[model samples]
Target: MTATLPRVDTAPAAAVKRRRRSLGWVAVVPLLAFTAVAFGLPAWAVLDGAFTDKGTGAYTTANLTASLQGAYLTALVGSVKLSAVSAALATLLGLPLAQAVVTSRHRALREAVLTASGVLANFGGVPLAFAFVATLGNAGVLTRHLDLTDKGWDLYSFWGLVVVYLYFLIPLMVLTITPALEGLRVQWREAAQNNGATTAQYWLHVALPVLLPTLLGGFVLLFGSAFAAYATAAAIVGSSVPLITLQIADALSGNVLVGQENVALALSLDMVLVAGLVMAVYLPLQRRSARWLA
Candidate 1:
């Protein structure tokens, strides 16, 4: 009664590992170059310009100081308010939509919604603003037919801008939250059911807790998206809305307020700070969600 031990080959695996390690830089170099050219240079330019004087190129804090005052300050506040409202609305609406898509029995419906979301999420800027204006603006098709203007529906105002933002923000939220929703395991539901938990109880206690981190992360993501939206808002409302992006454009192009390149860069610096804060919150939340989801 003898037992035999099987032999395993190591040379092929070792050679493959060595080959992969050697070839790894093939991908790394291009990515590094792209990052340097695309992100690094732009970031350096902003940092350099933010403190430098437009006339002498000498270092000063006047631009940054000016950016935090008067109309520029108002623009910053308006931008934050808009971003928060849009992101909040998007997160609330998109969660249920994502849930519906996830829980649906029909594969075709799920596929269609997901496909539509992917397209619509990235479908912002001029064309989208134009479409909305054509459909809802004064003298627009819907406006002419329904007389929405008389009924106090102004499509070029603040609330109107929020509505337009919702168009893309909701879709972006759907795409962002869908994966997190899918990460909700069936076994967890079954376990809760076995413990005599109702559907509501199961969700409220188990599901919501697990999904909270993801929800927060998604909110942060949506916030960043809405905060950075410039072209769409510009096309629809222009300088009518007191948004930081518009303010920056105005200053850079010498349209109004503080018309200076350094001031524009300083405003951009403020934007970078806001984005940094968002990333700071988002990264931790993502890590937490990953642990639970995994």
Candidate 2:
């Protein structure tokens, strides 16, 4: 027994395993640290400030209550309305465009469209607002040439803002839906054809059913993007558009109300709630979509 024990030394192997485990934990530390600093800390600040009264430093629900009343409520409604409209239009427009690109005979065309979508999807805020304003503003070249002002084309109005939003939202939808479209297995279509299903029948029965979740997910994604937009709307419509984001900025800057910074935080909290609801719906649909697309 003593000779057997002497021959079975495993200390070095155990030490190596322990060292690898330590390294694994060490690798994870930086990421955890970054998350805490970037998201966790800022979130805590918002929550704390949202609940506290600036004057007495006492926690209260008045700010939250106030966010749901009067102009604040209107702003929230406006934001929701704009986001829904833009997302719906973008989904309708982009799905077919993406389908066309995906089914295109020319590989170069597909590549060009996809490349353009990737770039345009990310192109927004000040520069985009500037471009639209220059091209569609009251004295803009197109506005002057086409007499769009006479046709009721006000670039700073609700419909105009919707049009501006669509510029980026459409590209975003194209980028999002293309992958799901590509994941449509060829065998499924062939199987449907062998069963004597026409193109419309195949899509109505099979393709649309499989893609419904992905479509809904894309809509939610676009909705969130439009809802959170600040800079572009700020640059274009300014206070003319009463978005929740604009309300938040106003509160923070005392542009509309002084000593209302906590109320702004509360509005931000409301936004967080809305975003949470969006994520709640989107995540489940996205997971279902992944099961099919994978």
**lDDT: which candidate is best?**
2
Candidate 2 lowest-lDDT run of ten: 1-10
| Candidate closest to the true structure, highest TM-score | 2
Tens digit per residue, CA lDDT, model 2, 135-234: 9999888999999999989999889999999999999999999999999999999999999999999999999999999999999999999999999999
How many times do residue backbones clash in model 1?
0
Clashing pairs in 2: none
- Candidate 1 stretches with Cα past 4 Å from truth are 1-27, 257-259
Candidate 1 achieves a global lDDT of: 0.94
Per-model C-alpha lDDT, please?
0.94, 0.96
lDDT of 2: 0.96
Candidate 1 residue pairs in clash (backbone atoms < 3 Å): none
Error of 2 at 22 (Å): 3.2
- Ten-residue segment with the worst summed lDDT in candidate 1? 253-262
TM for every model, in the order presented, reads 0.90, 0.94
